[model samples]
Target: MAAPSAGDRGPRVTGAARGGTGRPALARCVAVDPTTFAAAYWGRAPLLSRAAQLGAPDGFTDLFSPADADELLSRRGLRTPFLRVAKEGRVLPETRYAGGGGAGAEITDQVLDERVLGLYADGATLVLQGLHRVWPALIDFARALGATLGQPLQVNAYLTPAGNQGFATHYDTHDVFVLQVDGGKHWRIHEPVLPDPLERQGWGGRAEEVSAVAQGPPALDVLLAPGDALYLPRGWLHSAQAQSESSLHLTVGIRALTRYALVEALLELAADDRRLRATLPFGLDVADADRIGPELTDTVAALRAWLAAATPAAVAARLRERAWAASRPAPIRPLAQAALIAALDRDTRLVVRAGLPWQLVPDGERVALRVFDRTVTFPGACAPALRALLTGAVSRVGDLPGLEDDRDRIVLARRLLREAVAVPADDLSGS
Candidate 1:
């Protein structure tokens, strides 16, 4: 679909039922059709929208107050990893950099000690465990975008201040939908100049480094305000910078399984076959080597032909699996007994991890507790007692139904409390 032009207004969107109030609360000013865009430029750059994007709720900040953000940053061992501008194509270790604060400062110097800027642990980075609690609005946005793209979606968020460039200009491995949540930022999108642009499988190196040699002048340059969004297909070289203030944005990265990935996965599935597992050129003799060449080529050709024929079906199945799999929640690891007790005493507010399915239903004696994503369902007879736990109320196991002498329920509930899936009742109010 063509991007909404500066003078043209895009489609209007109303808030979904879950958005509450039943009124048209959140709306988008521009909405480009993804199918048309994908057909024309699946791996190219395209600006999606620049209007009404800011109408999405900002309630995510309320979930994590400045104090909660600080506690999370400190407790999770989160660090800012610096990307060497020269090696922008390479992934850096997570611990290599430190937070630089709101005002710009040298990596070696620690001037402002505030938690406002630099590399902070985004909820995704630290707890991959409780994203739903950290950014509920982004989760909803992902579902909306997924419906638009006709595929599953994953959303990640990051915050940076003026002069803090997260990474150097480069291409993403996957297509991306960038939403400017708060403040404004600048983007530089360069046209694809390399032959077979966006086809980096045979580039013999990372796309970022390979494209650097063929870098062209940016085709589009724009400053995105709070409600603006941009879509850049895979292999499009781009860079972003916050405009003299702090910025927060969510990047919805779409994972596309290409032919290369399918073949790789097939190879993995074929690992038990001696022919598939054997290294090529199996003999040292010159005659044997010459004879093996044709056979080896034939084997590769067969594999390629098979993959080429099966790719569409395979990719569709994989996408469906990924969509369902993405909804499952990460298992919460148990904390030390002492720490768990302390956390409970402090009346911490627990939050469900993002994407996990849950429903409230009436059971026989009380209410049945069924956690859909996890496939764990228990009788409603435990409702009266489990309801409090589900509601993050501070109640002991003894207060639960059918658990007077059972210790397993107590242990399980304690584990949940430690994971912040359940917390004391008082802490629930603010969050």
Candidate 2:
């Protein structure tokens, strides 16, 4: 299935965290059980699972194939950042692989197939970023895997001609799973120069250290064949070179939650303390450590008091805001949803959007439906029907709970359909 154009989807972000199912996606990558992987190698170590050792006989081909890459590069009218080319260790400028699309397109950076072809022949590596945002299968797989791991995730694919390497020995600030989709790639992995690096600490800061680490004996040295997978935590030094044939692999990067994030949440909660916001003494020598010592001591005491009084619930709310805002729910076809609203009737079938995180909250006399970025409120009488439709399975408009009249049910269903909270069940067949 193809992706919806950004114009067709509007302001809604199509990438959501929930995979809408069980742990099958995680199974496809980690050879060990989920519990075992979490305890042993999740962030502290690396795990490698060969093609024969992983789940699903089809491996990763179903998620993304070579043909799929071609379709995106040539037919998807892709823009930069979403797709890029690298030779040696440098990313080629957009002009190298993209140019103006002919009349009516207006876009100047639409990918040019001939340009990509020339670069591939010259040993440039194709890096396709954000496959989860544009590719249907990857969208589902990433969402599922993120749900299982309780982390924000993204997917990128690398395609290199034989004997070429796209990037130098380095480490990412986030964890990664390398899923081999086609051919072979010889890999050399070494221990981390800096363990558990935060987002702000990039490999560039310690390029010298990383280069040094790569010179040491590898902790693991192996060729990843089709269907094989490798898991690496952040700060691990590594590099790969394509074998005889071309190499294609998907990198599923995980933004694992950290203690620092929790500290951020707690500090945000500290904003409520008036002492923390108070000014220092007037005419105080701010730059002098001797003069500032007493002030810092008092400030520490005040902060300690605030921390002692803080509640887990308060910090949790801030974390929820940060995490929820970073992700998006499934996209709705606006035009199709509009059509469904116009034709909504008792017999019309409807289902809540898959993996949508929403709830009905009491808002005075009205009840508010909290989903995505906005709160949609309805009169208190609609609560029963909202609960039935949102919390229940795929159902008929007439089947909504507590709304005695079929007209009331249809009206509620139509309003919800307009809100993009639910879609016509038949729309699920496509992406």
Candidate 3:
């Protein structure tokens, strides 16, 4: 399967809380137990969870309804990269249905429902990109899932009319959870031609092999209805077409880690080594193998030395930090926080920021508190206060048990708030 063009996919992640914490959305969204799925099928094969409903109460249906499509298309004036129209396995150009000039000379693409609807009537699939950024419900759900899975997450939606297909048989670079939100879609899933492909190894060049394999009997073929979900691991070939009724499904892609990513983190850590940072022999060129050979050999030896010194645990820790940096932080209200910080007091309630992952390390006389893309070191005497503050339980700044000085405790609390490691207990939005 060829990957969608950059515009079709749009900029990814250009886009959460406690009490609803610890519970991963995936647990509720899958029919089989999460443990069972992880142990048996995760990164191994396709999983079809029948009658799975994400975002409970209202289910996934409320996230984007037919009414929403009508409202967004006719009134939102969406531009390219936000919406894409594909027909018969090909994506239609934005200009085909979008325009540049209007009565006011507006430059953005105005999504005319009539034009979009007309294309849909003729079998085009409408794709909504970056829904996690645009929809609040999806944002919360994505965050919950990310925290649960310990990976970055993104969301997209595909709406295909009856008896139509969006794209030809293909595989995704990232694992996807396909949630059928409305109507039904017939799916044909084949075993991976190349199992566990990396991000750079896309689906484009392997079309012939994919086609050849797909011609044989599929490993799994079924019709997915509303509230149903299909989990396809990366590199698993699959395709789906709308049934007699139109279909709308959400694809929640997990940007999973690979060995290559771990190596990247290792390389970054190695850069600090003088040997790794040294320049190659000068005047090295395609024709100068004699000189190039020794230089290349030396570089390889140095890299090997770096690798030999590396421990798996240390490398894993670095990769974990990199992943945390890439993920979006728990939601925060800047204005509210600023106002609250200005009125800092002993009576203010604080709790560890919902869904925020943190680490505290002992640093001799100081304690290193690492969180929210930054690290702060405080006197070891404040360890009790810091530990209590990060216990995920709510507490008033004034009532913290171990800390006695109101001034010092208040200062530490304010610093924690500023770093986004904790939030006021009253702010439900932050939670």
Candidate 4:
């Protein structure tokens, strides 16, 4: 696929020469030329591109309409350091940040609450859950980026107005790709004095923030117009502010797995055993330390050997599986009682969750359903009956699978549907 030019128009996907499948077409639109991006920002400074984000759905504002923004604000899901205030910083109440460590105070839950503010950074917040639903095009973009980077990708949406400070001048652990969706913003990037810094996840770390020197007079003082993007490597200290009436952007964080995380996960797995779960010999007498030395060394050596033998494919597979398992689908309220029943009774389509694998097989008279590692078969005569339940046909639990018979099937279907593993579709007619 050819690189998108500045004057390119239409859906970002349209710019790419047509390919055989939608996947390939989407791939061309989203694939970041890593070699080009890496040369520009990897371990050096920030790189900005005007219209880099033109392909991004409607440049932020167009992507999230007023109503859509309202819905996101009302969602009480995962919270993070999502909001910014002009001078006050985060708008969430002080109580929300009182618990946990000092880090908890850094994020404001008000962003997740959808409370609107003027002058203050007020806009819809889109985390993984929100993105999973209303943003298929973005998801496709993310998937393509992941494929190009050979790593997992996470895209976060931030909307703010002029003078809003999304974050302080600090470094993140993962590399970031910031795409301006609407309006404009001023960005300042500085060189990192401390190279490849790591965060302390446990207690007992110096509370002082590491200071860094300015690289080259804010390096690039550029205004991000709609459809523009910037790439910054991890450990690159930077800050941003809306330069226009309002600014919206999607920051895609590229995750890099470290040996430390791998070891930590393996240790947690090993802790399930009583022997490994025992307290460490720290603070113990010198005599006890000597006795534990051999065991500790042996364990460490074994872990090292195991990790050394691990293949990149296996690690990627495990990461993908974990990501899919953790993903939560958007909540869809059931239709009204009468409408649901009628719709289900009629032939309808049913679909499995996105990014999940499933298989269907012909059963004696019905069909066998398998999803999210679970499987079940319905009798051929009950195909229509099963369809009703699968398609959200019934209003309440007693609708199709009636409270009396087929209780097991009803329970199983309910569980799958609730988890978003199964969805109803229109019959023959793709909806």
Candidate 5:
């Protein structure tokens, strides 16, 4: 790809790109009506939203920068798989680009900047995988989106050198939103050969077929410039190549849960049932096959009935719990937080920890505040105040809506602070 000109670069937007109070920032990143997106093109078609000409003016620069790649490559000591090199649709082994750790022939998978730069100059696309684990900005973005979508999220970055393509036409197992950060890239998207393919179904098994179909007409073809965003459903065949200069883009992957997954989870839960736990009859020939078939049919019918009686809301709640538990909170300093809590008072300005989801459930005379895998209960009278803390802006213990007595509000605030559910408003902004 060719270098972007001065005109292509614009003023930078700081802070997180967000839509509305309840809306996910991702909704604004794609420039689409969230309701329309969910109802129409969510898992159906490809949609391109040209939100900006360059350097998206919607505070997206806070999520990533070109310098991030340089830091990871030249200083972070990234390992295999985390940093991969691909050229002309083929992946080069780490041994070809990575070197050993300092002072030893240990063959650590650390990236040697000179070697990686050399490979990049030679047209190898630099692939940085699982960036959400290492990049703080991405972790915040992914967690926020995951809470909005009620599923977990992952992020990866692709840095392709000018005029080079990383891989052949293929489909992703998970849905992807491509955020073009720098330079430009031409993309061609084709209809899915296998609609809604499972994670186990990869393009490697049918490369020739994919190449053949990709050679035909494309469903959508366009050049994505900086700040442009493209959403593609899982199983949509696509390929991209840098225009004439290096291209840097981030891919946020959404691994949506399917009804099949719910059924699998239910089956695991059903293992405790005596009927499901029973072993099959002793081995025999065709003589016993007919009897076994009838029993198996009966079991299937019972399982279907059980599944029918299972509530959809309950299943969804279970999945949400799992996703939240799997997500890691942004790093926190225990000692600093402890000190802040010790000094906390009614005047302390606080906010719900960013990226942490809190749900209030009423249980008889008590209200349970569920977050991560833990639930803390307080008197039902405190619901109003807890709700305010969960949903409102930076607030002080004195500002809790339902609590009339300052001492009561302060006690509640101290508990929350000590539990790390709420942090100082100024500290929350750092993440």
Candidate 6:
């Protein structure tokens, strides 16, 4: 790839990206109306939103720089799958480019920069996977977009050397939004050989079909420049080549929940049925299609009956669990939070973690504060103060409502600080 240019990049997305009135993360990616996108393009067709049409002058350089990629490759200790190298559609093995960690570190398979440089010089595409977990700017951007789209999102970056095509024409299992950060890339997109493919269905199974389709004229042929964004649904056949220079782009993959997943949840619920749990006919011919026909018919009838009786309310809880598991909360520094909790007082300032989702549910005599997978219950008397904290902004312990005394407010604040649900405000003005 190319070197990081020396100059001011642009305004980058930060923690503040979560609650903005302007175009949201999704709006920034797609230059079209949100309603139009939902009705016409989402999961249905390919849409290219040129950077010029995106309204904001800022490009994605602020999100990641070539310097950042070099730092990850040369400084951070990255392993095999996290940092993969590809040349002419084939992934180079770790043995060819990775080495063992030295001295104090006991692990092997750390990427060697010298090895990577040699591979890149010979025309290899560098794939930086799961960057949202490591890169700060991307972490915030993914969270903001995921919250808006009601689906989990992961980010990866592709940095290809000049004039090289990373992979041959193929499709992804999940939908993607390709945000071009630096330089240029020529993209050729074709209709899907298989539509709306699930995670288990990969393009490798249909290699011949993909190659034949790639030989045909493209449905859309365009050059993605810096600040350009392209949205491609799952199973859309596509390929890209770096232009005259290297191209650095971020691929935001959407992990959308599907009807099949809901059906899985329903089947899990059906396990509770005593009828479904009953054993099959004693000593039955398990492989005889003729003998199994009646049983299959009966099973389908029973399933339909159970499904008719099921309600959305029953399945929603499981869906929430799955969604929360897919999404990530901001990392909290344990020692710092511990210190803050110990020193906390009624005069201390607090800020709610951005994008933290929580709710108060009645739990008998207590109220349950449910955030992510955990539940923190407090006495019903603490309701008003808890309600005050959900404003998603800075607050002072002394200003919290319902707690009659400063000591009680301090106690509640201390618990929350320990929970990391609330953090100490860095600035008094909440700026």
CA RMSD of each candidate after superposition:
12.3, 6.4, 7.4, 11.4, 9.3, 8.1
Better of 1 and 2 by TM-score: 2
Which stretch of 10 consecutive residues in model 4 shows the poorest summed lDDT? Answer: 1-10
Q: Summing lDDT over every window of 10 consecutive residues in candidate 2, give the lowest-scoring window.
A: 1-10
**For residue 22, what is the lDDT in candidate 5?**
34
lDDT for every model?
0.47, 0.82, 0.77, 0.49, 0.76, 0.82
lDDT tens per residue, model 4, 1-431? 11112211111112232222333322232334446545665545666655543244444444343345445545533343433332333344433322222354554343434234332344322222335235555554554455445455666676665656655466777777787767778887776645555545311131134233433476567787776768787777677777746777777776665666565555544443455445665765646767878878866776666555555544433443444343332233355322433443223334433234333445556566544344566565544445554444653334454234556445544544554554554311111
Question: Which whole-number lDDT from 0 to 100 does residue 226 have in model 2?
Answer: 94
How does candidate 2 score on lDDT?
0.82
lDDT (tens digit, per residue) of candidate 2 on 1-431: 12111111112223232332333678788888778888899899999999888755667888898999999998888988798899999989999998899989998888899999999999999999999899988887876676567677899999999999999999999999999999899999999888999999999989998988899899999999998999999988889999999999999999878999988987877877888899999999999999999999998998999888777656655666676565555667888888878888899888777646665666778887777567789988988778777766437888887777999898888888887788887776212
Local distance difference test, candidate 5: 0.76
- TM-score for each model: 0.51, 0.90, 0.83, 0.56, 0.80, 0.90
Better structure of 3 and 5 per lDDT = 3
For model 6, give the RMSD to the true fold.
8.1
| Clashes per model (N, Cα, C within 3 A) | 7, 0, 1, 13, 6, 0
Of candidates 5 and 2, the better by TM-score: 2
What value of lDDT does candidate 3 attain over all alpha carbons?
A: 0.77
Worst 10 residues of 1 by lDDT: 1-10
lDDT of 3 by residue, 94-142 (tens): 9777776468756857666677878999999999887777666677777
**Candidate 4: C-alpha lDDT:** 0.49
Position 365, candidate 2: lDDT? 89
Question: Of the pair 2 and 4, which is ahead by lDDT?
Answer: 2
